[model samples]
Target: MSVDPEDIEPTYRWPVPPAGGWTADDLDRLPNLPPHTELIDGMLAFVSPQTMFHSRAIDFFTWHLHSLAPQGLEVVREFTIDIDCHNRPEPDVLVVDEAAILGMEQTRFPAESVLLAIEVVSPDSVARDRSLKPAKYAGAGIPHFWRVENADGRAVVYVYELDPATRGYGAAGIFHARLKVDVPFPIDLDLNEITAKRRRAE
Candidate 1:
């Protein structure tokens, strides 16, 4: 009585990009693009399926950040940053100025409004997360960056702080067991239990 989904011919088509390629604003107008679709160097980069490791690490870091962020800052997860006309990359988590939240419908944050950006490495996103995204975030002058990697079933965080002279991030620390930071507000986290379910004390 009902047509099976696989039996129906897909009517959707991938949009042919303009001569100059897709701009950041095109991301808003594109049809059927998957969530967290990125525009880098005027090209579209689709987000790959997430793993448990990736999702949990995001939850862990974002949870800690939301709890500790300063009064005038807000923590957001899985939102894109409108870095420029050609780049709108989404970090796993970000801390932004409270004023930058224009409304409930706003989808992207201005780069200058962001205080910190964090990315969690996935198998499919290794290059972008490790190299491309960080460079872009730094060039935009965001003050802080962190990259989380899965290592032997645990989370390892690489921290960086931007240098006003070079406009690139300088290594802050690499935390495997515990994470402690001063900039972007103080945060201390235990890495060993990052993926474990939090159980409230009785």
Candidate 2:
């Protein structure tokens, strides 16, 4: 018998304020959860069920990223990055050096090793993905960020590159049909292939 993920409830919950807040160590003590749970600013946030289009977008980008990643870097999906004591975000896709993750024992990947972080927006995660994550990733010194959003049944890739002097990302470009970026690595992606058509209800 298989348990439905939706039927399962989180085993742990953060204590209310006035009580001590949750830490990265506290998060690590919890048992494994369904892949959709994330720690944001010391609070646990549950991601809602993803649309088929969202899953396809992640898969599509992961495939192309893996194929075109720089020689020593690898692309990973739904991986946790330990940003600080209070924040551990699992990006939809991230790029890291192959050597940096070798023989790692920690449950979360170190932010220092991350090269690029990408988030594909879901309705439930719109605010966190668009606002919270971008600020946090830049502050952690991650060099690149990409946000994939659905616009009229198509994928729109928004690219950003970090400026060392300012410690913030500068918008590179936004692509509709095709995504092309030269920093970190060269990438050319077709948005059409990754987008899924919404099905009508019976």
Candidate 3:
């Protein structure tokens, strides 16, 4: 049963696993899983299983982003990003500072080092990703976020920066894929191309 969105209690929510409680080893042993899983502030949240369309979009973005090679950026998939005091989420696509990944075979991203975090919103993830997760991302001091809503041909790209009072993100602007704008990866993303791809998929 779906909880009444309005009546759900705050405590009943999920975030990554707790400090001194969950380790990288524990995250690694998650069952032979299909959909990726991550612990955020001690809460176990299951990432949405990918559909073919989702996979295509992911592949396209990862390819393009990685092509910007040696730009001092790292593209990670389904990895835990320590956001802040209250949140640690594994975004579908995470772009972290290359300096942060050095000198280690494996390491957890310190909350502050993330340059961009992306989420592909599925039916189950819409509310949390739209409402709750953004707040958590902002609180952690991460500089940028992009959420892709796949219900339609276009995606809602929420470009945000920190809000000091609420300790959350305030949307800088909302751009749809059909529109023209430079996506803040410090690069130009042709949203029209994304829309065209979506159309081809349909």
Best by TM-score: 1
- Which digits, one per residue and each the tens of the lDDT, describe model 3 over residues 1-202? 7888889666533334456666545655555534466655555667655676566556656776677535777887666676543355777777888878866566468767787777777777877778777767777777777777665666556666666676777667766654333444445565545546334455
Candidate 3 lowest-lDDT run of ten: 178-187
Q: How many clashing residue pairs are found in candidate 1?
A: 0
Instruction: Tell how far residue 93 is off in model 2, in angstroms.
Output: 0.2
lDDT of 2 at 174: 89
Q: lDDT (CA) for every model shown?
A: 0.91, 0.84, 0.65
Q: After superposition, how far is residue 1 of candidate 1 from its true place, in Å?
A: 22
Winner on TM-score (1 vs 3): 1
Using all chains and alpha carbons, the TM-scores for the candidates as numbered come to: 0.92, 0.85, 0.71
CA shift of 105, model 2, Å: 6.2
Question: Across residues 1-202, which tens digit of lDDT does each residue of candidate 2 receive?
Answer: 9999999996765445234556666666666555656778888777888897789988997898899987889888888888998888899998998876766564668999999999999998899988899999999999999999999888898999888999988999989998877778787777898864657899
Which pairs clash inside model 1?
A: none
| TM-score result, candidate 3 | 0.71
Model 1 TM-score? 0.92
Model 2 bad stretches (over 4 Å): 1-18, 104-106, 196-202
Ranking by TM-score: 1, 2, 3
